[model samples]
Target: MTIIRRSLGWCAGGLALALAATLGGTSITTAAPPEADPPAMEPTSATSTPGENYVALQFGVFMHYGLATYVKKRPWDYDPHEVSPLTFAPPAEMDTDQWMQAAASSGAKYVIFTAKHHDGFALWPSDYTDYDVASSSAPDRDIVQEVVDSAREFGLKPVLYYSWLDFYKDGGSDDEGNYHFVASPEYVQFAKNQITELLTEYGDIAGLWLDTAPGKFDSGRLQEIKDHIAAVSPTTAFVPNTHLTEKRGGTRLAPADVLVHEAELEGDLPCDATRPHEQSFLAVQPNSAGWGWWSFASRDTTVTTAQDVMVELMRANSIGGAAAVNASPGPDGKLGLGNVNLLAEVGALRTSPTAYVTIDDMVPPCGGTLTYSGQQTDSDWIHTRGTPTGGGKWFFGTRTHSNTVGATATLTFSGPDITVLFEANPGHGIAEISVDGGPPVAVNTYSATRRQSQPLFERHNLGPGPHTLTVEVTGRKDDASANTFVSLEGFRINASANPTIVPVANVE
Candidate 1:
């Protein structure tokens, strides 16, 4: 049997967490619940806007390949003085076709490769920079061209991830240890030169995923970069993963056609309907490999579970959000078999229908009380060692009121299971949870790893009919962590399933 797949993004007001999938050897389309009203967006000249096409593309792959892959050093930890251009080389048999073919098989609509990471290693030879593939050990290899051409062959869009902060050259005006300020006119010109090359040399591109920390550049500077891209590729969607560390009152200076919230906002799209948001996070292999954002050096045990990817995609679509998952390629310039297998599993899950219910406090029929002394922000809630995930709009404890002991979100629902979705970081505190007014149970939600939309707490096999789960902050911190902060994003209730969740297809 084939299930009618409807775009749940347009369905608003009904905040029911719905899950329906065709079972018994049939095809299904995964679906999730609604959380907020779609935002009013700026219309495009084209009938099918770039934002709409992005939303339709439910999943895409974010691949990393750079100096870090060769040296096996974390992107931020590598010492430029010690590195040599001769050291960077992929295996002789490195094949871009393999990557694109796998992406096609995994049901990905696009492939966004790291054209240049913070390490300042360019995949494509750039006329402005000698620190590129042409100058490296693989002098003749054009990884970017290979990836783009291969993606076209496999019927996938090619996008590039460009880092604004360049560690290779120092910005004369503001010279910091690791920070590169685009505020410097010289640096701005340098960026423009490089960007012009990327936009003009490359054929029609899907988009450019720009990554930069907030305060790195002002609104005017950001607009200049956008203007440069517009002059070259008018229709290419411009997505900036900026404003990661900006506070609530601050404006998202460099707002683009789309926003990428990496490991920050998980459950739903934090931005309203005006601008589309792409939900992204690192797919770490093992629970111990740490956050996979900049650790291309550590490839082992960094794979994300296929189950986690499935739920993440469902949650993204539930709130009119697209999903961009990061999976680092090995040092040999090839994806590992384990990562390939996980992608296949996720691809298969996409074919199967998944109906899930999600409840955000901002939405209707999901009324709840949020009591806390800390500030409430709908963005960048998860902070680890001074760096944040750049996507979260939830209530969290502050430094002044570090003790969130009494903060609570009491949710009422009728279901057999309840899963709490929230961000957990090194400074996070434990929560005291109670069901049906029973004795409170202490659940330690603290994780050294910084992540968003985590299903930290779940209760199953309940007695049905109108249940209340009260999650209260204990105002206590783990001895290892520095502060006693607590955070809450949203929740999901596994209520009655009108249509059962059955696997119709298996991904081999």
Candidate 2:
């Protein structure tokens, strides 16, 4: 959740060098070991818990407006304390109603507003600090209250985001520019007091989205904060953005009511249905100037299309998780017209005919449904075995992979089109896919970094009828790949229908 500016150039040189160093200049690849049985998929009940209710609100809009929005500086580029409080200005035309209207039109069920960011500037007149709205140009207004009221008016639940790494007050950095935060007694009490105000003042909030940089705080302090929240608002779910499976070096926040995948930083993975999960991404990429997170001057022209948002939403829903798309307001305190328009389009597409099938529900050609936690039955796939990784890494903690050349997995289904989801990593190989015995398409499933449940192959407009889709292992790989491995996670179709495909199940 640290908003570091990053380039879009996905070069693998750095990862290659790091991997070589880790393995002493030799490539070492390990396939998932075979599992004794597949796990059964669990169904959620009608009367769900708070966490499940949060997940049922499948799409949300994340508002990241704060002091950094006006300054146009990368969030982590400079010490936040150095920024003057006078720089925090929003025009009188600023309207939270407009923001909530855009969110509602986009079919978002909830809104996550950044009540306080890493700069430690509070949106409300907090009793704990003067570095808040009371000291800003808009001293007469309370931004948090406005947002909460507007969200409720628009029939959307409001969720507040609070960063625990407050750079303006409690956190400091070493000479090398690595930020650190210790949960001192005073700091912990200050956080508790502020949180108490938020929970008690804001009536019926849906949840609190807590964020911190890796290695910032100890577990005991986090538990203390959790205990305080539970005591004050037992109904508000505690969501921690710890990036559980990603290589960020911090202890996982234990006993979280919900987990999050910062999809922009970590690859998109399936959600663990046992607990609610959220996958968040920005509505636009970093501007050409490389400013991070919030919207800047140049960001208006670079918004992601509605189609892109629809794809992201579909992927999130297919995996039993919610999607939180961030749309930062500009310095003028208005959302970009482009983002609003695209979101509306996404709303329209949501009502269209789109279907998703997990691997477990897929009926194989050999007349049995695929199961993740039970004995394997006759299937169209050959030379593939169910391999178990961890739940956070793969669907159902298992994926099917084959290393043999000429291995194939065939599916006969009736649909306008289909997209194959799979695991792409340094060890994966190339695959040749064909539809209805049509032309073969080459797909290279290799990445310097491991990505799970990635949509690697997509086919469209195959005419209306039952068609055979085949995936053949070519036993070839990119030069950087370590081995000839091919893995499958799940599949999605453009239209709704029962298909002879595999279901992607949840992990423990």
Candidate 3:
């Protein structure tokens, strides 16, 4: 996300109220009749474009935690050259798990973590530069690794944000003390080395968010880096910050997998039918005194409520776009209480009866039961329990998976609609999903990239009664897949006709 020094008044009140009126305390409304036939399931391909995969993640959190958090300076006035590595003192109580919990509570499917900002301070210990977390006060902590582990444990995809302009290495004032941007050949090689380390060292990165590369890197250089990234991690998306580039009088670079619109309200930017697009904005607006993305000491109250976030989310979904709300952690590496509560409230709103209700594998409603059959002793269904404290209320923190052929897991529940959620990765296989003993639809849950809590099958307008949704392992996989494993996260159901919807005005 870019840091633009502009003030825009928050005017989400009317939109929030309208959204609530449309959804609150109303029976589930569909464009067609309640008895409309469910659509056919489309098969997934292993070679699907990265843009499609990225767009599947409808929401994510943008974390700006780094040296800028300690300085507490506005974006235009901050100078990274004056900040010392010693100032980067994160307490031992700094828990990435807590951060993931908050993100899970926000109903985000992915997390875009700032791996390296404009200050050239890397969260991971890169051999190319000494100005990183390894040289800071927390020398032993690998912040990137911690974030990746925590994000996976909470069933959220991890994406990295890297800045191209480095004040410590290739940026700063000239001999006359005038600000300048430089992209030296040696610096470019150093960046390439660091990027290789990031893509290779990490297990599976969803994408690489390249910031501040508009006027600095030319097409040739960008192409070189893009080709290199493809060689190492083929599935990782190469995304340039188009929002900042276009705003700062730079052309949008080619070969970009996704387009970014910074600080734009929902529906303001047109949806890109050819590629995926995303909008990133601050979760809490700055007060009268300006503050950067990582600075929040001046604001004690939350300006962006859960209703505002929900409206933005629903609008983005309507336009086939994704929303990444920026939330800053304080100098102590802890999220503000207001931000946590705001996220949790949004999660609760999404799972309300009027909204799509998420039912975890172990915790189902309407007397639902999950039964397994055709299990072998050597290769049987394995139930993995999630950490009780890691995932918030939205996540059940439990999953079931198996690689055995002919193994089936069925969910019997009383609901009008249901959607099956699963995990997709290189090791996953094809499965047959059928509703009420209907014709089975084959779904290939194989992807070069890894994503969790993905919707594999969905059905609506089943009336209201006891129904069965079954998934059977087919012992099949794409050519690029490693194995034939199938995993289940949970299911989402619309159970009741009477909906108790909370008004967005009340939340405000």
Candidate 3 residue lDDT tens string, 1-508: 1111111111233321111113366533223112212233232346776665775687888888876666665433444455556567888988888888999997888899989887677888766665677667777888899999999999888889987767666533233322235566666667767777787788888888877555545667777767666666777777667564556676656667677777652224453334577767777654622253564453455677775665455444433456787766776677777667777877876665233322221122222456777322223677655432333221234556888898888776544667777778778999999999999999988978776667778888885446777889999999999999988766665422211121111000
Error of 1 at 428 (Å): 46
Candidate 1 lDDT tens digits, 101-140: 7777767888888888776667887655556676566778
Which whole-number lDDT from 0 to 100 does residue 292 have in model 2?
38
Model 2 stretches with alpha carbons more than 4 Å out: 1-48, 171-177, 244-246, 249-251, 285-292, 298-300, 354-508
Highest TM-score against the true fold, candidate:
2
Give the TM-score comparing model 3 with the true structure, all chains together: 0.59
Model 1 residue runs over 4 Å out of place are 1-45, 172-174, 180-182, 247-249, 264-268, 287-291, 294-303, 354-508
Candidate 2, 1-508: lDDT as tens digits? 1111111111133431111112576444332222211222232243655576786687899988887877687656656545555567888898888888988888889999999887677888776665667666676778899999999999999999987767655533333444454555656667767777787789977788888555665566667666667667766777777774234655466756677888778766442334567879877744442343577652444456665565566555544457888777778788777667766766654543122212332223211123321223323232222443432344323456777777676655544567787788889999888888989999999989887767788887875345667777889999999998888765665423212123433322
The true-versus-predicted C-alpha distance at residue 482 of model 2, in Å, is: 49
Q: How many steric overlaps does candidate 3 have?
A: 0
Q: What is the full ranking by lDDT, best candidate first? A: 2, 3, 1
Indicate the residue-level lDDT of 174 in model 3.
Answer: 30
Ranking by TM-score: 2, 1, 3
The per-model lDDT (C-alpha) reads: 0.59, 0.65, 0.64
